[model samples]
Target: MSSIPELLAVTNLNELSINDFIALLLTVADKTDLHPALKEGLPEYFSGGEKLREMAGNLRQLRDAAATGNREAKAEKMAAWEAGKLAVAMNAQHLTMLSLHRKDPSLLNNIGLELKQRQQGGKSSVNVLAETPVVTAKHVQGPSGPVSGSIVVVISRAKNTIPFEMQMTDDPSNESSWSSQGIHQKSRIEYQELEPAKRLYFRVRYHIDGKTSQWSPTANIIVL
Candidate 1:
């Protein structure tokens, strides 16, 4: 754990393997500028949020180079990405922590984070592990008053769990149809911009001390 609540205490790059979590960190950092109360006390880490988005862009470039066999750029892009991915994620987290201290911690929900979390030095769970994670969720409202089409996914976590992945698919029959929502550090994640009135399927899997769990059973919800 970090000595200061404002500091993010991640020790390894793998802790931020999911670009979604990086994305989540960005959502909080960038939105602070719009939060009337928080805009006045923005933390320096939000600057890291800008850098994180750039890192994500580089990651996509690396993927493109790898996919198209653009050998000339792969090494260059990969090296730069490796040099900054963890810093970007951790810095965003660190800055958000400081911002939270200046405002209501409840803002965590507004930013898609659950207030209760454990991976960061909280008490460890001792129950025997399930073979796969079980996912549950509720839809969130839009800013104006109607349904927002956002899904807040929740999962039970064990002490061994490090981070988890969330994915969605409309065609469950096709193995190749699944689209990833990216990696998230916490179990309670929000799914955004889903098509209305369509059946959406979701699943989760966890990474432990370098091992991965089997994918969870499908959990489906009909968008409002």
Candidate 2:
């Protein structure tokens, strides 16, 4: 355990050094359960740190608040903690966008569609799909040959019937490596064909009223 003086030494948010920022993110990544897409992409943003001692110490305040038996204070602290976790996720997304934009500006296009939609005069659609959709894949026969089969998307909390897109990739580590299969009305798409012994990875995104959600966590299948 680090001493109080050591923990207090962490740079404040406004004064965060590059190392400190990385440390903070690394710490959060280790401690919290995050959206699967964020979980897979965030680690590449920073490297060479196992923990953020100062941030860890700060989290102890949450524990203390919970122990105090003050309902209001505990609720407030927990809410702040939840907000902080979200901030981390959003921050990671921003950094990734910047990097992708630098490599290929078009890659960042539609990356923050939901946020952009909110800024563009408010939500145009009554439906809001904030949660990342989960996708699955299966192998089946096609008219021409064997296909990677179709992708099935499940959006658990969607309020409206909306169009969804499928992104296919062979390299999971490279976000830019994906090829979009475009949008469709139904929840399933059967357009992808695969060679024998090849693997296909799939992710789905919802698009409604000119806005889209981030791609979901990947699902994969092998063509027999």
Candidate 3:
């Protein structure tokens, strides 16, 4: 019988002789260091490490069978390989998220925002709502009367801290022209009595702790 190390050195699939398979099996068995009773329970072909060697021979036979154009065997091996790769990728992603969260606790919040955006059809799931842009004659009467139009916007956040002062802008260059609104934990906003017949643009600004985030994408509302 060839030594365990000799078996591990056999790299050529085409040259996998019976002795080579047995050697490979011995290598695997030696590495596992199974209990004596468990080792004894194995068939004579595997006794003292022969069992593993036989298994290696069987594996080579399967491989040869696959090479001989057994589509099913080839597919099975391919599926196993893909599954192993997927498992590795999932593990990598989990580790990455753990590391990122440790470095920046706010990463979870960002991930939540991404998930919400996906759920909301790829456009920003966050919205801002309001009544009509037209300052209808009825709305001019005051806040007490029924508002003819209302606007509502929704924003998504993973964290408990809500954004401060969501805003709207007609143009990106005119920062001072932006209008402000209060953000709620529910990620929604309502603006009543918007002026009629105007082209209005809206954006959201949020802060975590004291650090402020950039504005959300601007949405345009045309009030009749």
Candidate 4:
């Protein structure tokens, strides 16, 4: 067994949630200040920060669209956010790994990474076939608010969990009509400002480790 610590391989940074990815960026950036060792890779080390911020900006557009119930704009913004996030994270991972490469792996502590002691001959990683978690329509609650288009999907949660991506569409038959409702850490999510009297559809999905689950079974509710 190798007594030396090694960086925990986060080979799929794209699988991280946006907020988690941001946290990782903050960690590495902060660590640079404490580690004079990073001086050589300093400039390049921070290069991905700008892209991270831009991806965050794209995320804000998604948030705004979801809040106002502009489903079409929400879809567009979600697409932009996803693409930007993937690109930024992939680039940052490459740069961060390069900066830390060949350095003391103990430096990984508190840098949004875990350190694992290396084995002389590591066991081959096993491929676990990840099954998609199932989600039911659960319950669709009619609007209690005075608003004409407010509706709530009362999803019961067992406890605290990562955000489940919510998506909606006015027409289930139309593939292009689906739009993001943004992510909700809570199980119960409410969507408002929907077009009145329209039959809308909803679904949920989440990512863990390196796998993304298939979209949940579709749920439908008519906007009041």
User: Highest TM-score, which number?
Assistant: 4
Estimate every model's Cα lDDT from 0 to 1.
Answer: 0.56, 0.48, 0.40, 0.51
lDDT of 1 by residue, 145-217 (tens): 5475777778775543456667778888864456556656676877688788888888877643222456888
Supply the global lDDT for candidate 2.
0.48
User: Which of candidates 1 and 3 reaches a greater lDDT?
Assistant: 1
Query: 144 in model 2: Cα distance from truth in Å?
Result: 18
- Order by lDDT, highest first: 1, 4, 2, 3
Report the lDDT tens digits of candidate 3 across residue range 1-224. 94212111112322433322233333334432443233334333223334334444454455545666799877764554343333323322432354354674333233111222233232222332211111111122236754445555555554435543355655656653554343334555666767766666776545322123455566666544
Instruction: Enumerate residue pairs that collide in model 1.
Output: none
What count of clashes does model 3 give? 22
Best by lDDT: 1
- Model 2, residue pairs in steric clash: none
Off by over 4 Å in 4: 1-86, 98-147, 156-160
Model 4 C-alpha lDDT per residue in residues 81-196, reported as the tens digit of each score: 56654554444455446547755444444343333332121232111112233344322344763556776675433234643556677777754456555445666666667777
Q: Against the true structure, what is each candidate's TM-score?
A: 0.41, 0.39, 0.31, 0.48
